[model samples]
Target: MARPPRFDTDQLLDAAVRLAAEGGPAAVTMAAVAQAVGAPSGSVYHRFSGRTTLLAEVWLRTVERFQEGYFAALTDASPPSGGAGGPGPDPARAAARAAARHVVVWSRAHRDEATLLLYGAQDFGRAEWSEEHIRRADSGNARVFASIGGLAADLGAADERGRDRVVLALIDLPLSLVRRHLRAGEPLPPHAEDLAEECTAALLR
Candidate 1:
């Protein structure tokens, strides 16, 4: 039987995430990641082809993790029962609130990964990414757009402006709330999720 190596891909990626979160993309060099994880620099290179690939992996991993839950939240059409026997909460609106609240809740839960999201793929060296990496990033983006577009239609706002509003309520607004606090190196407040849900409900109405 073959023995496992000391540093695995996810371990290195985790170190890269912390480095990127603390000092931005420029800080996530192979040497820095290796040093952060107390692994040989060769171990970092063993998993990723170069700094560009490392950056790409870290960015994609963080984004994909965030989006997995976000996509689900946006697509949830089931509404909560209102009181004991009243009609349930509006399914579309409930989904919108859930999706919006998910942003803050996720950020609060994954602060380091959330910080990675504040910067665009371009900031993470996307221009140098492989075609495969580009496709992965594009695919995630297309899914998000489709989910939001679908939700907008369900909420009776299928027009372009209405879709834009959905985008704002679901993506831009909640992210803005997270960005402000993360950039300041402050923790998200206790009411962040409630505030996100409330603001989203107001916009979707």
Candidate 2:
């Protein structure tokens, strides 16, 4: 039987994530991650080719995790077609509400990961990433837009301006709230959840 490795991959990623949360992406060096996990630097290199790869993995992992829940919220919010073959309640508003509230719920639950996202891949020098990494990033972005676009279409945001508003309420509003609370190192305001729901409902209506 093969001996298990002493250090776990997720342990290393968690260290890197916390480092980014505390000091931003510039803080997430391979050496730093190794030290944070009390492992040899070679262990990190064994899994990641270089800083770019590490950062890409970090960003992609965070994005993928976030999208899982977000996609579900969007789906739950969506109103089934007037004929899934019978009339049903319109779900556009409910879907928008779920997506909006989900942002706050998710950020609070994953505060450290949330920081890494808000810090953004740009801070990790994503522009200099290898083509493969860029493709990965683009694919993730496309899925996010597609989910939001589906909701926008359901809500009848047929014009560019209308779509933009959907983007603003669903994406910008919730993220802005997360950013503020994350930067302050404070919990989300009690009203933030209700406020997010109300705001998205207003925008989509």
Candidate 3:
């Protein structure tokens, strides 16, 4: 039987993430990723057809990984259904807090991937990708919007304008904070959770 290749797809993507984190999307060429992982250029091409495809895979994989945990946090921390029969404060508020903490905590935990995602994904040409890739990207975005949109409704946001405010408060604002810190090569402080939660409260209020 033939022996396995020296490097796997995940390792190449991981190297791409590092490159993206260090120098943004412009640095994530196939040669660069292969060099970072000490693999032959052919190794990268074995999995990804070219730079755009490789970048799309890298962006999609990192985002999916992050969203898995983020979505879970949102679900697990959703406010209880009824005070008479369940426990907890307002579900919307609880969900908001969970969402906020996930932004900080997840970024701190996965700094390279998080940094790459925050800075490079959209820049790496999702718009020019193949139809299937575009569909995948669109669907992923739709799922996130749907999840957060539901949360906004549950939070008593009035309509589309109100939902936009809720999303800006809970998702965009916290993510902006994380993006800034990650790009600066700084770890999010332990107090980031508290800061995010407090800010979310203020924004929603």
Candidate 4:
């Protein structure tokens, strides 16, 4: 029987994540990743075709992980009552709070990954990736917008366009705030989470 693969894909990716986090995408060359993981360069090539493929995989994996955690938190925060007799929590408030907290907490916890993802452009160079990857990114973004739209409608925002503006403001404002702190070489503002939550609430209202 053929033997199973020796190195774990997750382990390799974790090392790559740390490297990218510490040194940016430019630090994620195959040689660098291999050195970081103490693995032979051939191992990286065996798993990924090239630098583009490896970087794409790392970027997509990081985004997916964040999305999964945020969505799970939203589900968990759901109210224990209502909604078709299912045990799931009421999604409205829970979803909003969870979304806000998720972005703030995840960004702070993985500042390197966040910075790499937001700032580093993954140059696919016309290489076609799996449709699933595209869908995953789109769907996660859509969910955030949908949640914001629902909240805006609840608060009687003038229209869909108005709701979209509010959504953009809520999401982008916090990220910009964090980016400013990082750029200034200052510690993240202690009230960052509070600011996000308050901004989200106000937009919804």
**Residue 105 in candidate 2 has what lDDT?**
80
lDDT of each: 0.88, 0.83, 0.80, 0.66
Per-residue lDDT tens digits of candidate 2, residues 1-205?
A: 9999888778888899999998898899999999999999999998889988888888888888998888788888454232112322568777777777888888888989998888777888788888998898888788888989988998899999999999999999988988898888898887777777777777766
On TM-score, the leading prediction is 1
- What are the per-residue Cα lDDT tens digits for candidate 3 across 1-205? 9998889999899899889888889999999999998888998999999998998888888888888877876766655232122334676777776777788778888888888877645698887777888787778778877888788878888788888888888788889888777767787877776677778777876
RMSD of each: 2.6, 4.6, 3.8, 5.6
For model 1, the stretches where C-alpha displacement exceeds 4 angstroms are 80-88
lDDT of 4 at 76: 55
Residue pairs with clashing backbones, model 3: 79-91
The pairs that clash in candidate 4 are 78-89, 79-89, 79-90
lDDT of 1 by residue, 3-58 (tens): 99999999999999999899999999999999998999999999999999999999
The positional error of residue 64 in candidate 1, measured at the CA in angstroms, is 0.1
Across residues 99-205, which tens digit of lDDT does each residue of candidate 4 receive?
Answer: 66567778888776666566533443214555665676577768755656665564456776776755654566657767787656566776776676666555544
Show where candidate 4 strays beyond 4 Å.
Answer: 1-6, 72-94, 120-132, 158-161
lDDT of model 2, residue 117:
89
Clashes (candidate 3): 1
For model 2, the superposed segments whose C-alpha errors exceed 4 Å read 78-89
